[model samples]
Target chain A: MRYLTHKLIAFLIALMLAPVMLAPSWAQTPTLNIDVNVGIREPVPFAVPIFIAENNGAQAVATEISRVIASDLISTGLFREIPAAAHISGVSDFNAPVQFADWRAINAQALIIGAVSTSGGQLTVKFRLFDVFAQAPMGDGIQFTGTEEGWRRIAHKVADTVYSRLTGEAGYFDSKVVFVSETGPKGDRRKRLAVMDHDGASLSFLTEDNAIVQSPRFSPNNREILYTSYESGQPRVVLMDIFTLQKRDFGDLQGMSFAPRFSPDGTRVVLSISNGSNTDIYAIDLRSGARTQLTSGPAIDTAPSFSPDGTQIVFESDRSGSQQIYVMSANGGEAKRISFGDGRYGTPVWSPRGDMIAFTKILGGQFHIGIMRTDGSNEKLLTRSFLDEGPTWSPNGRVLMFFRETPGADGAPQIYAVDISGRNLRMVNTPSFASDPAWSGLLQ
Target chain B: MRQLSKAAALAALLITAACSNTGGLFGGNGDGTDVNGLNGGPIDESSIAYFQQTIGDTVLFQVDQHTLTPEAIAILNQQAAWLNANPTATVLIEGHADEQGTRDYNTALGGRRANAVSAYLVSQGVADNRIQIISYGKERPLAVCSSETCWSQNRRAVTIVTSGPGV
Candidate 1:
C-alpha cells in the first residue's frame, strides 16, 4: 500500500526545501560544482540527533526513525554522520532554539532535528534541516504521517528530503529493487523473484523458489512487476501485481520470450522473443496485447529500457555482428548504434536522467559494468570483475546497482551498488545470492 | 526321420511363445527385465537412459559462440542418429550459457545454441513437432566455478529424452 503523503498528515507545519547556492567553504572543493564530476573529495559531515518524541507513545519509534534517517544519509558514502553519542546539545522541544556554537565546535556542516507524535492511531513525524555554518534553517520544517507499520518508509521520506536539500538533487532512499534470489548449488539453483527496499529491508518473495524467474523489471508506477518465469517450461513474460501477488503470463508463443521491461509510462512491455536462432525485441501494449516488433533481424536484441520521457528506447543488438547498444523509436523504427567501444556490450539501460546508458561490457574475458554517454562518448567502466553485469540505475541516476559473481566453486553472486563517480562500491544485503536487480522508481 | 522333424518344429513353437508372452522365459537368456524402463529400472538399447548414457546427450560450445564446434557437431550427429532410431522419444533441448555475459544476451545466446542443435537434428530426419527447446541462460551453470574450465562445460545444449507414444 502507498503510504500517506505528508500532505495528508495533520500538520502544524510542513515546508519544502529550496535549492540554493552552497556556502563557499563546502563549494570550495575542486569538483563539487563541476558538471564533469570526477569529484572524490571528503564526505560532507552532518549530524542527526535523536528525534524528540512529543508523547511517550512515540518515544521508541522516534529514536528508530531518526537512526534510520542517519543510516540512510550515511549509506550514500557522500555524507559522514556526526553520531548522536557525540552530540553535546539535544533538541528536547520541537521548536527549541539551536545552539550553533555547540554544532560548530564539532565541525558539522549541517544539522537535522525532528519530532514525532501520535494522534488517532496515526504517527506524524516532522523534521527540520539546519545549515550550521550559516546558523539558519536550510529548509522549512516538514512532517509526514502514516501508520506505525510504515515507520521505515516514513523515515526514508525524511532522509530523502534531507539528502535532496544537501546534495541539490532528488533522493533515492525511498526506492525499491526487485531482484532474483538464488539458492542451492549452481547446477540446480532455485530462483525466485524478490522485492526489497533499496537499503535492503522488507524483503518479500513474489514467486515460489521452485520457479526459475529471470530479469524482473518494475513498472513506472511501482504497482506491478514484469518478469520472465519458466513455469510453463518456457521463458514467458509474466506480469504480477505487487500487492496481491497474482500473476498473469503472456501464454505460450511460437518462441520463448524473456528479458521483459516496462515502458516509462507503464503502458507497454518490451521483451525479446527467440524465433529459431534469431531473437528480436517486441513491444506489447499492456491494455490491448498488441504486439509490435521493434527490431526484426537475425540477431540478438534484448534488455530494452526506455528513456525517462518515454519517447525512445535503448536496447542491445548484435545486428552489427557483435552485441552493441542501440537506440530506436518507441514505436519501432530504425535504431542507431550507440556503443563503439572495443568490446561486446549488452544489457543497456538508459539512465532515468536520460543522459547516459549503463551497460554490461565484456572484453578480454573480463566482465564490467560501465556507462557511456547517450551518444556513445566518454565510456567509463565503473567496475571490473570475473562477473559483473546487469546494471540498474538508482532513481536519481547518480548510483547503479548490479550483481557481481566471484570466481571458484564456493563463489556466488551478490548485489552491489556504486556511485557514478566509481566510488563507494558496497555489497547490498540479501538473504541469499541475488542477481538481475531492477530498481523501482521512488515511491509516491 | 519324419518323427524327429515334427519334434523340432514343436520345440521351436514353444520357444517363440515364451519369447512373446514371458519375455524369453525358460530360454536361458533371462531377459525378463522391464522394457519401458520406468523408475530407472532395467534399460536396454531402446530405453531413454540408453539415449542419455550410451548415445550421449550434451553438446558444448566456446565462449560467446553458439556456432557448433567440430566436437559439438559430432555429439549432435550421434544425438540425431539416436533420435532417428528412437522415434517414440521426444526431445527437450535445454540451452545454457556461462556466467560470462549478461542475463538477457546469454539467454538469447543459449537459445541460438539450442536452435542450432535442433536445426541439425531436424536436418538429420528428427521430427520437428516432437522437439521443444528452452534457454536457461546463465541461470543454470553446469559448473559453479567462474573460470573457463567450468564455463566451457556450462555453455552447452543438453538434449533431454522422454518416453512418448509410438511414431
Candidate 2:
C-alpha cells in the first residue's frame, strides 16, 4: 500500500513538471493570426535642468547644452522634460549638493546636471546623471574636450551619455546627417549633396549640380556615402568620400542603379539595378565591383537593406501586385513576404539593433511610420500624418527622423521627427523644406 | 484655325506622352524604377494640361541651388500672364529634384524647387492662394535612360493648371 502511494505521488509531480517544460515549446510553434500592436502608454518622466557654469561667461554655453539635451530627450517621447518654472529647486552650481527633497516634490524620477569651462580654445565639459528616488548618482561623470566650434557636439555627447545610462541603448547624438540640399522652383529645382550635424547644425553642401543624386547612405564607418547620381546622365551608384568630397561611380552595369545601401561591414553595397524594363536588387563588392543579383522576377525590387547581422536583407518589392516589405537571405535566396497587413510598405530600413525593421506604410491615403520585428512580427505603427516618409533611427533606436509635409497655403513639404512611442511629434526646422532624413550613427 | 488647333493638340499630345513616360507629373508608378522605362500607362489629361501650358519647358535652377534661374523667372512671368487671363485656373507647381542627392534631400530639394517658384509668383502679383506646391522628389523622372540628358530633363518643375473646385 505504501509503494502504491509513492507511485501516485510521483505521477502527480511529473504531471506538474510536464506543463512547465512544455509551455515554451507550445509558444514557439508557428501560427497564423493577425497580431495588432497596441503601443506603450505613459512614458517615464525625467528632469533636465541647465547645467550650472563652473565660471562666469559660461552661462550661454550651459543654457544651450541644457536646451539641446531637453530637446533631444523630450523628442524621444520616452522622457518628459520638466519645465524650469515647475522646478522646486534651482540648480545654481554643477558641484553643488543636490536637494533631492525638492526634486522629489516635483515628481522627477531622474535628473541631469553638468558644467562647462573653456581653456586654450578647447571646451571642457563635465556632466552627471542622478536617480532622485535612490538618492545616488546614476553613473560616474564624464568629461569632454574639443574646440569651441564643437560646443554643440559636447552637448550632444552629454545627451548621449545620459540617454545610454538611463535606457541601456547606444546614443545617436554627435552624429552627422547627409542629404540633398535644394533651391529653386518645381520644374527648375536645383539639388546639391549636403551634410549636417544630426541636430541640424553645421550645414555643408557636398555636390554642385544639376547632377541629380538620390538615396545617399552613410557607411557603417560614417566616412563615406553610397548614392545614385545622374552626373553621367544615366542612373548609376557612386561612392563619395565624406571628407574629401571626391566621388567615383561603380563600374560597367547594364541597367540603372538606385536605392544604394551599405552592408553592415561596409564591404559591399546593395542596390537595385535595372536593365531595360527589368529591375532587381544586386549586391556588389565595393572594391572589385563584382555583383550578385538577389532577386529575379518580373516585378521590381528596390530599397534593399541589410539586417544587423549581415545574414538577411529586408527590402521593398511589388511582387504581390502592390508594394510590400520582404525578407530574404543575404546571399539571395527565396524571398518571403513578411508584411501581411492591410497597407502598402515602402522603404524598409533595418534597425541598427538588428531586432526590428522600420518602414513607411501607406494606407487610406495617409502615410505612417511603423516598425516590425525582423521576421515581420509585432508590427507597430508609430506615427501617422498627411505625409510622413523616409524614417531613419537615432543611434539608440529611440527616435525616428522623417519629413512631414503639411500642405502650406502653397503646397510645400516640411521636415519633422517623431519618437518611436508616437509622441513628441514636432517639426525639425530648416531654412527650406527638408525630407529623406538619414540619421547617422553616433560619432565615436 | 482648325489646323493650328490640331497641330497644337498634336504637340500637346506628344509632350503629354513624354511627360507621362517619365512618370514625374502625375503620381509616380511608386515602384521607384527608371522613370524613362515607365511606358506602362496612358497619357492622361493632367499631363496634357501640364504640357500645353509649358509646351515641354520646365523651370531652371542655377548650379548647386534650387533658387529659380532667370529662365525660371521669365517662365513664371509668363505663367502669371496665363493665370491672369484664365481667372478660374489654379496652379499646382509640381516639384522635381535632380538625381544627384539622397531621396530625403531630394524631397527637400523638390520643395525648395516649388517654393522658389511659388515665392516668385507671389512677388509677381499671383495670389499665393491660387498656387500650390507638391514635391515629388526624385521619385518622378522625365528621363529614364541613364544619361546626363535624362537627368537634366528629370531635374525640373512643371506648373500644372487645374480648374478650381467643381471643375
Candidate 3:
C-alpha cells in the first residue's frame, strides 16, 4: 500500500511539472532578465514540525531527529526555520495531507513532515517535503531504516536530500572531517588525530598524544587517513585504516617526510620529503611501496594536491625565489606558476568542483584565506587573520574549513568554516585547540 | 659596559635556574655547571657552552629573508672556529621563523635559512659531516609574544651540539 502511494505521488509531481518543462526557451524569455550570478544571500523561510511518533517509545527519537534536521538546514545559512508555535495546523498523522493554506499563511516556502517507528531493534523514518507556494507535495515521500545508534546519520541523510532538491546542488551535511587536536601550552603542545561529523559532533580520537601528529587527510575511499607523525623523532608519513586503527609507516625512504595527501584514486600519496638540503614533492604507491620524485629542483616544492580528474597536481614552490602556487602534470614536468599576486601563496587545495583552488595567502604580515580560478584569475579573499592557513574544501566545494591562530603568549588555534562567497563565517566548536582540518568524501 | 650587563643577565639567569627543578632555561641534561657562563671561572673555551654564551648561538634574519647579513657572518665565523676546535661534537642547526608567514612557505624559508648557516660554516672550514640541519618553521617559537621584538627573536637559526664529545 505504501509503495502504491509513493508511486502515485511521484506521478502527480511529474504531471504538475510537465507544463514548465514543455515551455519553449524563446517563449519563456523576458525583456528584463535578472542574472543571479551571486548566491542567495537571504535565507529561505521553511518549517519543520516535530515528527509524529508512530510507535511506542519512538516519540523522543522523533523529536530529536526533527530538531537535528532543522538545525542542519539552518546552520547552512540558507534556511530560516519557522517555530512550531507559529504553525496554524499541526501534523499528527503520517498519511494525512498537508494543510498548504495554513503553511502559506505563515509565509513558509517549504514544509517537511515526518514520522518515526521502531521495531525489532531497527529504527525507521519516513519524510515528505511540500512546496507551500504551489499547494502540493514537491516529490514522493522517502523512508530510511538503520540501527538505533545511527539515528544522526539518518537525520543527516534527510537534510541532505532536502538541501539538494531545493538548491540544485549536492549537500555536504553527510560528511566527516579529520583534524589534529591540540592540547597543553604553546611551548609544549601535544597533538592527536581526531575525526568528527561535519557539524562538529560525534568526535572520536584516532591517535593518542604520545607522538606529534600533523595534517591528517582522508583518502578518497573514506576508509583510511594519511597523516604525518613524529613518532620516530623525525616526521614521516603514516597511513591508518579509519575503522581498524591499524597504521603503517611509508617504507623507509630516508629523510623527514611531511604533508601527505592521497591521490584521487586513493591508491597513492604525494608528500614532501626533506633531505637535509632541500625539500621536494614525492608520490608513493601505497601498495607497492614504490616512490617517484615529482619535482626535482634546488627550490622547495611541497604541499602537493591533485586535481579532481587526477590528471594534474597543484603545489606550492619557491622556484621563482619566493613561494607561489604552481600546476604541473600528474607524472611530473616543468610546473607553470599560477599565482602572481603580490604576496606568497601556499597550501593550495583544488576544489572538488574542479573550477577553483583555495589557498592560504600571506601579505603584509597577515594571512588570508582566498580562492582563485584554476588559471589564476578572479582572486577573492574570504578571510584575514593573524594566522590562517590550511584550507580544506567541503565535499560540495561551496564551503571551506581552516584553522586560525590568535597572536599572543596565550594564543590558541581554532577551526573555522566560511562559505566560498565570503559570507556566514562561523567557528567550529572543538573540544580544544584544533588545526589542519581535512573533509572526507560523503559517507557510504 | 655591555659586557657588564651581559654578566649581570647571566647571574640573574643562574639565580632563576637554581630555583627551577628543570635544568636552566636551555635544560642541558642534568649538568651542574653553569652553561651561560655565570660562574666566570676558567671556562672551557672549546666547549659548546662557551660557544653559545660568548659567540652567541642564534642569528636573526629579516622578515622573509634567508640571506645572512655581515653581523650574522661575523657570528658564524666565530661559531666555525669553535666547531673546528671541538671537532668531535656533532651540531644540529635549527632554523626558525616568525609567525607572519604560511606554515609551508615558512618551513621552506626555514630550511633555506638553516642551509645558509650550514653552508657558511662549511665555507669557514667546518666539516659538513659534523653538522646536521632541520627547519622547525614557525611551529616552535622562542618568543611567544606577537610584537616585532618577539618576532625578531623568533626568526633565528640556532646551532646546538646534539651529540659526540662533551666539554
**Global lDDT scores for all candidate models:** 0.80, 0.69, 0.81
Model 1: chain B TM-score relative to the native chain B: 0.71
Estimate how well candidate 1 is docked, as a DockQ score: 0.35
Q: Judge candidate 3 at residue A207 and give its lDDT.
A: 86
* Clash counts for all predictions: 0, 33, 0
lDDT digits (tens) for residues B1-167 of candidate 2: 21332454576566646756567666666665322323545433234344344433378664225667677777778777666656666766766765443353355456657767777777877887797665566666565543456666667777766443213
Per-residue C-alpha lDDT of model 1 across residues A378-437, encoded as one tens digit per residue: 999999988898999999999999999887787788999999988899999999999989
For model 1, the superposed segments whose C-alpha errors exceed 4 Å read A1-40, B1-43, B165-167
Worst 10 residues of 1 chain A by lDDT: A4-13
**What docking class should model 1 receive?**
acceptable
What does the lDDT read for residue A154 in candidate 2?
70
1 or 2, greater by lDDT: 1
**TM-score for each candidate, following the candidate numbering:** 0.87, 0.66, 0.86
lDDT (Cα, tens digit) per residue for candidate 2, span A178-228: 776656543345666766766676566667756666668899887788887
Using DockQ, give the best candidate's number: 1
Off by more than 4 A, model 3: A1-37, B1-40, B46-48, B165-167
Query: Candidate 1 has which clashing residue pairs, if any?
Result: none
